[model samples]
Target: MTAVSDRRPAAADPAVAGQAAEEDLRSLFGQSTAVYASLAGPSHVVHTANPAFLATIGEERARTGVPIAEMMPELADQGFLALLDQVYRTGEPYTGRDVRIVLSPGPHAREAFFDFTYEPRRDAGGDVTGIRVIGVETTQVKHAQRLMTEHRALLEQIARQAPLTEVLDGMARCIENLAPQEVLVSVLLADPDGRHLRHGAAPSLPDFYNQAIDGIATGEGVGSCGTAAHRRQPVIVTDIATDPFWADFRHLAEQAGLAACWSTPILAVDGGLLGTFAMYHRTPRIPQETDLALARVFAGTAALAIECHHSEQARQAAEARARAAHDELARAVRAERELRAEAEQRAAAAAELAARMRAAAAAQAAKPHPERCQLGGSPGCTAPAEVKIADSWGDSAWGCLAHAEEAIISVRSVFIASEELGGLAAYLDR
Candidate 1:
């Protein structure tokens, strides 16, 4: 009698229906890259979850038969757990587009976006028993969009010829904000000769650290950035504390709490050194392909900025030299004009003096014998006229020794004169 029709129909059994619903949901999303999870019972224990779901919540919470809240305590504070509860009790499905959440909240937390749905699962009696979560992470899409916007802005800055330092600093900040993990971005500018690197930007690095490495030389074993620059290639130091390249800077890296550094050399189109772009991490870790790609992209940007800066400096230098040359030529022309004017004045003065001497000589021609010195001005000299001086225009004067010497030295064309004296030599002979 107890065995009579004891088995119930599969549709009537709540457990069977629940199992079928879970299978259907899994079959739809299990193989997909999209995240999928099914919670069971009023407690909303994680009954089944795909790899994407486990990865999204973190692998540490991958176990089933545990309440979602306990498995992902961080989600409770983020309001995700409450949403799950609401869907379970109200039997309503909720869909969210571009929902933002911070995973593993703390200093190491990361922001993630998702397009997701929370559909309540009903049993055979139409009673809501659990919630099924299906989600696709939009974090990369969002990050890519942001990266494009920031990259465009940087190009604009370069196009407008913003200061290199300003562009580099902004780029460092942008990369720091863009990276999913905490990263310190630094750019070092190469010297004109490419023998050393100067600090271009490091907004996230400690001031003391930045100053210490401000002008590190480019050479082998000179830390990641310097070595990268010297080799003209990328350098990846996964463990700064142990890498030979970091031997000289190990203590500094330790003090700065840096464990890893990846650097890519920025080069000009002609293969000249521009600078280095570096990403420093607090933990020792290898860089992925994506990380390398990011470095290359920004290194090119740094090159563009540095090249623009150098071109502008060269143009300014040339303009300054041209201006100086123009100024010097103008000064020379003005000086030449002034010299010609002064020469003409001297010539005119000499001509007038000659004419005055000739008039004086004509007045004195009447006297043949000596009197006082004729060249003596103001108070007359009582010395006998011992010398006769004449001008080039046949003007003659009689003077004592001192007056004759004075006249010969001061007058432009004065000379000794007499029938027996041919020049100053004849007067001296006498």
Candidate 2:
């Protein structure tokens, strides 16, 4: 079996060759924090491994003549052993990109991804000797891709104006699914006054626990979420049982099987507090970088959703007021139109009455004495005739002072025609 140092071709200048060899080794494994190993023979016995490989699988197991399968038995079921077998038998290389594997077992189990290749190695005699395993870790890339997909879906829901409760609940579920470990996610919205935090979403939490903290006030030492909102920052309670902030709620939290809590305040762009995004753990555990990053990402998303919701509500309310104003204007216009129509009708009637009175006057001028009480038509007037009145409808009558007064009141423009008697007062005096 050949070591990595001996496999290189000799250079004309030994000094240059040494430097080139060192550079080649560094280049092959640089920019990667993944395990790399070389296996020799048909049995796939471990020949050598890089520092990363030894650190991952354990330094005690980093020895030659040990079969790769014996060292990392977990890879046997993950199809890595089959890939190595295929490469060794066919003299062809096999590459697996973004392949997920669960390394170790029980409490030590971790989710990992690899961009790896298994290539056949050849001896000087042209026969296949061993297989070379080169790989780069892609766990972070895998997690990021998943995170973006879920986050984009949430944004789309918000864009379409989904119910606020539905959006918040879905976001909480998304984080729960994407977390590396079991986590209970809760989103608490701030009341309009900013003094109290209201439960927005907490699917995994117990109903009793949620009710107990529904309207928790935002103040110093109020609780993890309350304190986070009050300070407008993140609050981490690694162990709820021992933390002073949890003294009031510790019994409830313990009953709910929640041991750790990390709360981050969701803030608007103007620095106003919107709500809190919290992650609860069943066991007491410190947060990793990934956990904090997840909190920040979802916290920003929550802020966007809340702002959009508030804007939509405001716009709807404004539209309703505008509609009411328009209706009022329409009513006012109709009333004005009715009043103008009534005034025009009254003016037309007055003009028609004036023309009738002029015709009556001309008719009276054509008659000599205007016999039979000029103001009487159906019944004879008991009072003597003293005034002559006529109308354009070819009707004329004579009447006394009392009858003449009645005629003027009932008819459209009938009055005394004589100017010498000084009208009705003179007739009455006489």
TM-score winner among the candidates? Answer: 1
Residue-level lDDT of model 2, residues 20-103, one tens digit each, is 744665567654476677788988998767777776676655666799888888888888888888888899999889989887
Model 1 residue 2 lDDT score: 58
TM-score, model 2 to reference: 0.69
- Model 2, residue 116: C-alpha shift (Å): 0.6
Which clashing pairs does model 2 show?
A: 373-397, 373-398, 374-397, 374-398, 375-397, 375-398
Which sections of candidate 2 miss by over 4 Å?
Answer: 1-32, 57-65, 328-430
**Residue 133 miss distance in model 1 (angstroms):** 1.0
How high is each candidate's TM-score? Answer: 0.85, 0.69
Whole-model Cα lDDT of every candidate shown, in order? 0.86, 0.82
- Report the lDDT of model 2 for residue 205: 98
Residue-wise C-alpha lDDT for candidate 1, range 1-430, written one tens digit per residue:
5567855457766687767767777878878889998888878899899888888877865788899878877887788888888888889999999999998756867899999999988766789878888899999999888888998999999999989889999999999999999999999999989999999999999999999999899999899999999999999999998899999899999999999999999999999999899999999989999899888888988898999999999999999999999999999999999999999999999688656655545544554757778878888888989888776466677899999998877776676665343233222222
Residue 61, candidate 1: alpha-carbon lDDT = 50
Instruction: Note each model's CA RMSD in angstroms.
Output: 6.1, 8.3
